[model samples]
Each structure stands twice: as C-alpha cells, then as structure tokens.
Target chain A: MNNDILATLSITDATRKLATKEISSLDLVRACRANIERRNATLNAYLEVFDDVEAQAIAADTRRAMGEKQKLLGIPLAVKDNILIEGRRASSASKILEDYIAPYDATAIKKLKDAGAVFLGRTNMDEFAMGGSTENSAYGPTKNPHDESRVPGGSSGGSAAALASGMALGALGSDTGGSVREPASFCGVVGLKPTYGAISRSGLMAMGSSLDQIGPLTRTVADAKLLFEAMRGQDPLDSTSLDPSFYKEGLQRKKIGVPRHLLARGVDADVLKLFEETLKRLQEKGYALVDIELPSAGLALAIYYILMPAEASTNLARFDGVRYGLSRRGESLFDDYACTRGEGFGPEVRRRIMLGTYVLSAGYYDAYYGKATQARRTLSRECAAALKEVDVIMTPTTPSPAFLIGEKSDPLSMYLTDIFTVTANLTGNPALAVPMGEVKRTKINLPASIQLTAAHGGEATLFSIGREIEAV
Target chain B: MYYDAMVSKEEVRALAQLARLRVSDSEIEGLQKDISNILEYVGQVGSIVPNKGETQVLRAQNVMREDILYGPATGLINKGKELLTAFPKREGDYAVVRKIIHKDE
Candidate 1:
C-alpha cells in the first residue's frame, strides 16, 4: 500500500491489508507518525505523539505472527486524552488534572489494546469537554485541517482533525453534546456518537455523564463500523452499560427519514441544497425517503445547555487541585479551594460551571434544571414516536459549513453550530456524520454532511444505512 | 427587555461568588457586559411552555452496583503517583494537596 493510503486508509481497508500482509503494522504506524509530524504543527491536533508507537506496532506484528486473530490487529488509532491509557496523561485538556496520569487503562482502551490496535497518541479537546469549539482546551485550539484559520469543531476537534488530515487511520472521540459530530462535519470526516450507554465510559473524564459517550472518527462509514463493532459491548465496571445485544446484525440500505421541518430552519442555502441532493441520491440508490416532522427539535439546544452544564458543574467539582493538577498555595482551606479552581479552569469552562451552578441552585432549580429535564422527557418521547415511523432521521449535521477562524467570538453563534446535531445527544439516540461532497462556488471548500440518527438500540440501522450510503 | 442588557456590576460580583469563582473588579466589568448579553440571548428559552404534566425527573441517583465493596481499590495511589510525577511541583508521599479541607482541632 502507498504511504498516503497507509495514512488515510479507512479501518476496513487497513484491516484487509493487515490480514493479507499487504502492508505491515510497522508501515502503518510509521506513516501515521510522519503524517502527524507534517500536519499537527498547523492543526494542533495531538497533545502528544507516543515515541514508542513503533515498538507497540512491532508487538502487534509479533502477535499476528503468532496466529492471533483479533478484529483490530495491527491497526493504528489516536485517542482523546480524556480516556485513560495507563502511564499516559489523561488531562481531559483541563489544567486541574494536568499532572494526573491514569493508574489503569480505561476499559475501552484496554479492549482496543487487546484487539491489537496501536496507540498513536492522545488528541486535545475542550477542558473537561465543556466548550462547543476547542478554544477552551488548556493546550490550545485544534485548528481545522481544511483551513488552519478555522476551528476544527470541538471537544473532539483534534480527533476529527487527525482523521481528516490523514494523521491517523481513525481516532476515538467523546460526544457530550455535538463534540464528535460537529467537528467531524467541520473537518469532513465520519464521526459516530453511538447510543449513550452503548460503549463503556469507565476511564473517560466525566462531562454530563448521562450525555457523554466515546465514539469513532474515521475516513469512511465502513471504517467507523469496524471500530464501533470492536469498541462496543457491555463492561462489568460501568453500571450504565447495557447488554451487548443492542448492536447486532444491521440491515443494509433501507428506508430513511428526513425531518423537513426540523432541518429547514436556520440552515444556510448551500447546506440545505446539499442535504436535499443527498436525499435525492439516496432515493436514486433505492433508499426510501419519508417526510417527518419533529417539533421537539427546536428545544434540543436549550435542553442540552441546561442539562449538560448542570451535570458538568457536578462532574467537574471533583477537581479542586486537592488530588492532582495545578493548585494554588493559600493560607486557609477556602482560599486553597477557591484559588486553585479560579486559576485552573479557563473562561469558557468557568462560564459553563457557573451557569450550571445557577440552574441547579435553590428556587430556580424547578424553573430551569427541573423544567429542562421535563422537556428532555418530552423530547425523548417525541423522538421515540418519530423513530417508530422512520428507521433513521437524516439532517444536515451543522446549520452552516465551517466558518473562518476567529469569526465567532460570540458564544451563542458558536452554540448554534451544534443546533442540528445536539438533539440526538439530548435524547440518547445514536447519530453519525458522513460527508456528502463539497458545496459549490466558495474558496471555503465547504463540506456538506448528512446526520443519520437512529433510535435507542438502533445502531444496527445506522451502520447498515451508513454502509449503503457510503457505497453509493 | 433593553434593561436586561444593563447588568449591574454588583450583580456580576455576587454571581461570581455564588459560583465560587474568584474574579477581579476589572474582569467583573467585562463579565457584567458579556453575561448581560448572554442572558439576553439565553432568555429566549423562557418562551418555551411545557404542558401541564407531571415532570419527569432525570436525577442521577448513585449508580453503584450492589457488589461487595472490598474497600478502596488499593495501589491506585502508585498509579496516581506516576501521573502526578509529571507535574512541575511535588511535596511528599501524597501528591502535594492544596488545603481544601479543614479538620476540627
């Protein structure tokens, strides 16, 4: 295989190559390392590239030579720093845990290692996965590979960028809101946010635990399927994990739902045109398109902000600089607690934490946090009803294509980028972002994407339809 | 509605304290202006009217399984130490903890 192919090849192709001994694991890891060195300077995608990756690749090759048949043998992948890899810093891109090394491997990391995937390095992200863009990352923002001046949509921006720029064959990203999908759309790569409890969150830095899920970012639909099939399953440690039966035997290209009303508003003309064209192509390819309306879609952003921040405030409260990370010296206990957090967390993280604290505070709880939960219930019900009619709901992943770097200083505008994708997260539905060719006429190179959302335990439909859509 | 944009400087300070964030007076001024703008935008959510129905609570109850607790997982400190070793600062056996708690003497 060519070096470029080794670097950018999807998981399925790489696996076939490895199985056939067409390209050795050493070649893939070395190509990935070279790609990282070439692009990461501008992209700022990785927090660290493990120097010992070649050694790990060698070990995987040794195992392959020994006749071990694992699904991910000899594949190379990047990991988000939030997920623990033993002896690696799981910073979560937050200064509070800047020094904290994982005592043990995250269950998913352990599983991937067991499957024989080589760890390339860790990708950067928003501190504790707080911000919509990676601007809140303690390390620095991961720039979009398409245009270095623009943001690679965040908290999984680095992972998406790595996949988009051919730095890694595929990478792992966590979705708590639109972290994975939004970035994938920005970078024009495939990203999946599986059902909330589909993958274990044992070592992932908690950020709204209910909404947080680790998913895959890859070059193609089948590549995503390969990684998903490998990483998914119930883990004994995570109580929220369901039995592994939910994701099995997916159907091939079938009827897909298009929520015209939900996707019609606030979307750019070019993006909307691209979305309609995607539908047309899918229809031509024999996939049935059904018109569906989901009114709860408008309320998704509001509900997510409320619920996600509330959980985040609680989840982030554990990092007081008492255990690890940057701590400030103080005369008294209160000063120690206050000073450390005040100095450690960035402005965006502090803002969300404050907002979360406000919503969950007394008197206003019933009005804000409580009511948001009720809205979430209604949203879940609406989505469930909608899914019953259509196997998968499709929409533009983002309202518009990636904007210029430093274009959106306003938080509201930044949050709106997730408008199309966040609902799936709020309702715990599985969603995937797949590129649907480029938009016409701008030097911007706007890549349009269609989001495929499946019902709870409907990842099978997602993967099957994704495979079909990709083939076309 | 315009008055919503006119946030008081004192209110911003109080909110910061309530959120346990330390802020300088200069930062508070900027925050007051920005937060006022944000609240004005976020206020759009107030338009949402839910039906008169029993509210569904999604409170995260402790999800600990009924497994036997063999006490805290031991030797995790060594792992924690390996992680903390990368930090620029160090004290002793314990990762030099900030004075976050007070014991009654």
Candidate 2:
C-alpha cells in the first residue's frame, strides 16, 4: 500500500500486514510521519511530531523479527498530550506544564508499548481538557478536517482529527464528560469511553479524576475493540481500575433501546432527521428497536457539570508552584506561589477551579456538590434499569455536528455539546459513537453517532452491536 | 437575578485572589458582570427540588495495597525529583516558593 493508504489502515489491518512481513513497522511509521507533515498544517492535529518515531518503529520491527506473539506488535498509534509516555512532555496543551516532561509511562501507554505498538507523537487538546471546542488550548484551536472554520469537537479534538486525517490509525483520548465522543462524532470517527475503570488512568493527567477515562478513537469499531482489549485490565496503580470480567460478554441480542424523549430536546433538525433514519435503517437490518424512557437522562449534563468541576477543583490543587512544573517568582514566597498559578492556568480552568472550589467549600457543599452526587446515583440507577430492558441505549452522540469555532462565545452554549454524551460518563457505562450518515448541503456531513451503552463490563455487547450497525 | 444580585467588582477581585488567578481591575469588573450574567442562566439548577437526603456522595473507596515494588512506579519519584531540579527556582531538595502565609505559622 502507498503511504496514504498505509496511514489510513486501521490498527488491525496494519498489524496483520506487519505480522505477515508484507510491510515493515519502519515503513508504516515513515508513512504516518509523512502524512503528518503534509496534513497537520491544515488540521492542526498534533502539537509535536516525535523526532524519535523511527527509532521506536525500528524497535518494534526488531521485536517482531524475534517472533514476538503480541497482536498489536508493530502497530503505530498516537498518544494524546494528556497521556504520559515516559520522559516526554504530556502538557494537555497548556502553558502551565509547557516544559514539564513525564517521568513515567501511563498504564495504557506502557501496555501498548509492551504489545509492540510504536508511538507516533502527542496530539493537542483543550488546556486541561476544559472546553467543548479545541479553541481553549493555549496553542490554538484544532480545525476540523471536514471544514477549516469549524472545530473538530474538543478536549480530544487533536486525537479525532489525527485519526481522520491519517496522522495515526488510532489515538487515545481522555473523556471526563464527552471529550472523546463529541470530537469523534464531529470528525466522523469511532470513539469509545469504556466503562469507568475499564482502562487504567494511572499516568493520564487528572481532570476530574472520578469521571476521567482513557479509550481509543479509531476509524472502525473493530479497531476500537482491539485497542480497548489491549489497554484494559486491572492496574494496581489506579485503585479504581475494573477487572477483566467487565468485557467478557459480547452483544448477541437483536433488540436495542432507543431513547427518543431524551434525545429530542436541543437536537438540530438535520441531526435528528439523520438519527431517525439511522434507527429505521437498523430496524430494516432485522434488529428489534424498542423506544425506551430513561427518566433521569435529561439531567445528565447538569449533574456532570456540578460533580466534575467539584472533583477538578480538588484534583488541580497540586499544581501550586512549590512542587515541580512551571512557576513564576516574586519577592515574597506567597507572592511567588500566587503569581505562578495566576499566570499558569487559563481562564476556563480558573473559572472551573473557582466554581469547583466554591461548591466544595464549607458552607455550600451540601447544596451543590452533595446534591449533584445524589443526582448521579439516580442517573446510574436509570442506566441500569434501561439496560435490564435492552442490550444497548441508542442516541445521537452530540445534538449537532461540528459548529464554527467562534459560534458559541458564551461558555454555557459551548458546554451544551456534551449533553448527550455525559450520561454515559455519569452512569459509568461503556458507550461507543459509531458514525451513522451525513446531512444535505452544508459541507459538514452530519455524522449521527448512536451511543451503544451496555451494563458494566458490557463491552462485548457494545462491539457486537456496533459492528452490526456499522456494517449496515 | 439582575444588578440587585449582581456580584460586585470588589467580590470578583476577592474571588480572584482566593482562587490564585490574577485579574486586572478592569478585567475584574468585566468578569464580575459577565460571571453574574452566566450564573443567572445556570442558576436554574437551584429551583430543582432534589429528593430529601437519599443521595449518597460518591467517594473513592480507599483500598490500601501491600507495599509492593512495581516497574511502573519504579522510576516515578526519581523523575519527579529530576523535573523539580530543572525548575528555574528551588531550595535544596525542594522547589522553593514564596511563603503562602503572610503571618508566621
């Protein structure tokens, strides 16, 4: 295959070629680097392309030559800036840690490397994974590959864009709310937020540690399943990591749940039209579709905003200049500490920190943070109840497709992008965003993603149904 | 939810200080006005009547593990030390900072 074709092949396809000795890991890495050089300017997907990718590729080739039996042996992948790859800068695209390099590999990165996966480079994200649009990054917003002016939905914008533009066959993304799925939908790729604790978060930057999850954004559902299996399992480093039992069962049912009432509000007309047609198409494929009601689903975004920011505020307190990372000096010790944080963090981050701090503060904690957590319990219960009735929950990943970068100047409007995807996060349920189809006119092909959420450890069901729907 | 409930520029400055973010005086005024406006929208959550005391807060069930040495955390502390050393300012074995408390502890 030529360089573009090689770069575009999913991880499974690339690995099969490598295992058969048809194409070397070196060729794949070089092709990807070349594609990055040619396309990254327009896509702005990557903040830094590794100068040492060839070396890693050579290492993978050496391992394969020695008869290594790993499935991902010789596959190339991208790590989002938020994921640590020992001794590399894992900046989450912020000035706060611009010069800070990670000392250890994240559990997911370590597993992938052990499986002989070659590291491409770190992709960009909204600073601290704070915004719905990539525009919050201090480095500048990542443009959608489909349209230059529109944003590739964010926090994971660079990861989704890199995969779409062929910089890497697959990339890992961290989703606190809908960071991964929203961007995947906007870019027309597959993104999975495996059930909470499904993938280890030991080396991933803490952004709302309770809600954060690490998963893959790839071109196909099979590829997502491949990466998810490779990186998932129990990790001692992350106390919250789930056992392998969560992924044992696969989706075999012909029945699926479609939540029409939940998805009806705020959904753009074109987006809803495409979503309804997708359901019709699935119905025609011999699948039983049941319209279900998730009563607490509408409150997902509201609950997420309350709980995530509360966790984020406490988690980010460690970046105080007294420890490692960036800092600014002043005449007095207090002045130095204050100035460093004052300048280091961006506005949205500061806003969240303040809101989080206030909610968790002594007086109002009972009213805000306490109440949000209670609602989250109800949300999780609702998900469990819905899953008992069907194999998967289907909905549009985002209410709309990629919007213009500056279209949502108001912060609340920008936050609405996560409305559909947050319920999965709130419920700690595994969900996948599979591209359904496109809309008319606008250069944007409205990628309607049906969210397939299985009960905890229900990845098999998700993948089986995702494969079926995607095949259609 | 109008100017009557408006967060004043003075309060914004105090909030900025409390949060360790620097806001210019003019910026504080703008933020005070802007944040108050934004809160007015999000304030709808206040009207939501949550069930009485049934919701249990999600807490990390702390699990203590055996003191086992592993490869992943192996080089972590050393790397942290190295990065701390590289920071522009530091006192022996620590990243030096302006004392946070103005008064003696």
> Backbone clash tally for model 2?
8
lDDT of 1 by residue, A11-62 (tens): 8888888888888889999888888888898889999999899999999888
lDDT string for model 2 (A85-131, tens) is 98788888888888887878898998898777888889989999998
Q: Once model 2 is optimally superposed onto the true structure by TM-score, how far is the C-alpha of residue A338 displaced, in angstroms?
A: 2.4
TM-score of 1: 0.92
TM-score, candidate 2, is 0.94
DockQ of predicted model 1: 0.36
Highest lDDT: which candidate? Answer: 2
Each candidate's interface RMSD (Å, one decimal) is: 4.2, 3.3
- lDDT (0 to 1) per candidate: 0.80, 0.81
Candidate 2 residue runs with Cα over 4 Å from true position:
A444-446, B1-6, B47-53, B67-83, B86-88, B99-105
Q: What's the TM-score of every candidate structure?
A: 0.92, 0.94
* Runs in model 1 lying further than 4 Å from the true structure: A248-253, A440-444, B1-7, B43-53, B59-64, B69-105
